[model samples]
Target: MNYELRLYLDQLTAKSASIELNSTYARAIYIVEGSIAIKNGVSTRLTLSQNSALSIPESFSLGGGSADAIMLRWELVNEVDNSNKIQASQSTLLLAAKMALGDLSQYIIRCDRVDFPPEGEALTHRHLGGGIRCLLFGSIQIHTLGNIHTHQPLSAWFEAGPDAVYAATDKTLASAFARVMILPRGLIGGKTSIEYVNSEDKNKPKSQRYQIFIDELIQH
Candidate 1:
């Protein structure tokens, strides 16, 4: 089914301060800073620390339990759910757009981290699916669709799957970003979605690394 993919950067301050996040869409939360306490329904409390990731369906509440915390959330919404718009609760909506997912049964929602060394560059390439990405550290220069932009930490941008893209990392430091992509279910077992435009580029030494966090095939 067609859906709207959304990204939000949520912040929480002070201890015991909680925020309600009620949504019917599937969500993936990555803790960017500090720690948090999550409560599902009337009971069931869980704590997530920095760098931790959690995938949950339906609704729940997440709050900062110690010090302040930061979270990056990715959600997928159905077209028919437009009537019940998401009410942003203490979170900054980074990106939101419709996804041409004709059907989700043959799709897989994946979250992964890509890292490039200093002065590293990704040759011209395209992917099998589209999604939003957020830079975590250092910087990156992305050139695609006749547009170029350099992103800093916390900065986000959308990557079109079929469009060719070329990226370069900061000259002085390593760059990394965390992204959530909706890809074909066939690529579920750690398969890559990138396809280099020039076959010779694939034979060249690669300077980037990948860490897959979530790879769940959509359940009909």
Candidate 2:
């Protein structure tokens, strides 16, 4: 698996600013702030701000305009070594929904770019199963067995030890947030599962549907 995912930040304040491309490489870009016009053979202007992105191909001629903006760039390296893993190409503009975790047949994992508005909470629950969650943005307070575990930005959680029993509190007191990636590792000698239920649903039994839910997650 490729483990070299990166985030780049570029702030542009000039007009008609551009870059050239004549080779082939796969890459993605997000307009974290401001607007820009992109040109390959023709000009395609995109006025983006806050979390918007673009994927670029290495083989095309590239140019663009920037109207006071900042962009986040995500690129996939080493195409020849991982040809089977390549699905999204460079030179394509991508929104939040377009970002994804590709191929899960060989692994048990689910990554989501979640968004929590200000003064919002993710509800109360327990990770009674096994998995890991990497927080790529914002903050969260996790509860495990009625205990408080507050994590700030770039924090992570893992379930690989005997002391993995945990849960979260329902009382939330924060603003906009997101849970970037949640993954279940291959335990050396342990069990693993992921589950979620609509708190609004009353027909399902709590914790009884975790296995089925995890299996269903891999399909997406």
Number of the predicted model whose lDDT against the real structure is largest: 1
Give the per-residue lDDT of model 1 (tens digit) for 144-167.
Answer: 989899999999999869999999
**Global lDDT of model 1:** 0.83
The Cα local distance difference test for each model comes to 0.83, 0.38
In candidate 1, residue 29 scores what lDDT? 83
Alpha-carbon TM-score of each model against the true structure: 0.90, 0.42
Error of 1 at 89 (Å): 7.5
Question: Which residue segments of model 1 deviate by more than 4 Å?
Answer: 41-43, 79-89
